[model samples]
Target: MAMHTLIKEKGISGINVHDWTVLSHKTSILNSQEIDNATNELGIPIPEMIFGNNFLSIEHKSGFKLEFKALPALAMVDQSSKSSDLIKVSYAREWFEKRSMANQEHITDVVKPYDWTYSTKYNGTNLSTDKSLVFSPTTSESIDIEQLKKPDPILFYDENILFEDELADNGTAVLTTKVRVMPSCFFILLRFFLRVDDVLFRIYDTRIYHRFGTNTVIRECSTRESSYRETRSRIPRSKGGDLSLLLDSNWVSSQLPEKESQVEVLTLSQA
Candidate 1:
């Protein structure tokens, strides 16, 4: 691993390693200009915190590539007004009608008709060719939960939030990515968690695992969700945690039901 102290890019720090397989991660807070550019390009109002300049990508000499970027991730957000999955906040109807009747200058709290919560199902973008692909309907080669439980030393570990919003104080919508490199393998998790207070909790997860010196990469993707009340019922009545637990995405995600899950494999050329 090398530092940006030797070679930097536009006030951004990057971790760079050169080999047959290269890993690069760059993150920097965007300025007002950059935020405006992102907003214009995306054609949507930007979130409260959009890391427009952040990205995590891998490139192999053998035409295998994958990347997680803020722009593409934000593009996956459901901005449709007619979408069935729109969060049903109690004040949604009143907020919509008021925004339509009131002058743009007079509008204070609410802004647009889009999914203010900014729920997204994006995992990551795989730029590999057709030759390096496989399909799996089972979890035979999925991310080994037990393996991750081992106390192996993590060589490289980093996490970053691509975007986040407070949902106008209703709840939170955030997307984050975590990467850990161990002795034998590397693992990546892209997570999108959404919570609407007293409404529902939703989580989308993407897990990728690749062992060193192997050409195979296993990816498991899943979505889980449950209503706020249902999630609350899971708490034990005798020793129940407080409502604060519901504010935690990690806790809420575990309490939800799995709606969909799939596993796939990508076969890359030996590095």
Candidate 2:
């Protein structure tokens, strides 16, 4: 229930981007009503496997905590778009088991999440004049801990769209895209976005968090970080719809789990 402090161990500390805590020791089942509601809101079907009792819950310090219930939507996109540029990334339990056979092999070797063409505009005028706007597996450069914290060099490819929502009091919503891949602890990657309020005051998020192990297990444990950039103009309506831009966000890779923390003690239930 306690959160670890944001230490300056890496020499990149100004604004704390993320802090995480493991909130679930076991999974819980979901009723039909919960599934139905989520489906209606997301415009996608919720998977049955997500209701399994064996689940993991995590809380982000500055961001949103991604639970098991949010995985399916975040991991797979609705196949409505016929554009070939849009790609979907999927994973299975076997992917994690095989990775145990080797060390130094990374998940990115096989799958790179958040592959898309990016374009930025201000008042309908393109702003990304210096660099290539496309971001994908082939174009993505390998990132380290330092790169994850800073806002420059533009590591990951992201996109944002604004829409009108009658249910929203502000009448407008913005969705900003992001993706992450973790092969070492959990063999999973998720490409999802956050629906922020008109003025960027509130956030509704969905993310992918994978679970592994049969008898005894230690799930993937790591911290995530991100930086943001605000719009220069005061009149968002005249300039552009978005109020803030996600400079970059990613998991901390340099840190490792403690030996004691990696082991678990469990009690079995009699059938």
- The candidate that achieves the highest TM-score relative to the unseen native structure: 1
What are the per-residue Cα lDDT tens digits for candidate 2 across 76-108?
A: 433344321211122222233334444535444
Q: TM-score for each prediction?
A: 0.78, 0.23
Which window of 10 residues has the lowest lDDT sum in candidate 1?
Answer: 1-10
Residue 128 lDDT in model 1? Answer: 66
TM-score attained by model 2: 0.23
Compared with the true structure, what per-residue lDDT tens digits does model 1 show for residues 79-185? 67544234445445534454456443332344354666677777787776655454356656777778788898766667777888887776788888887766666
Worst 10 residues of 2 by lDDT: 117-126
lDDT of 1 at 257: 89
Each model's lDDT: 0.70, 0.27
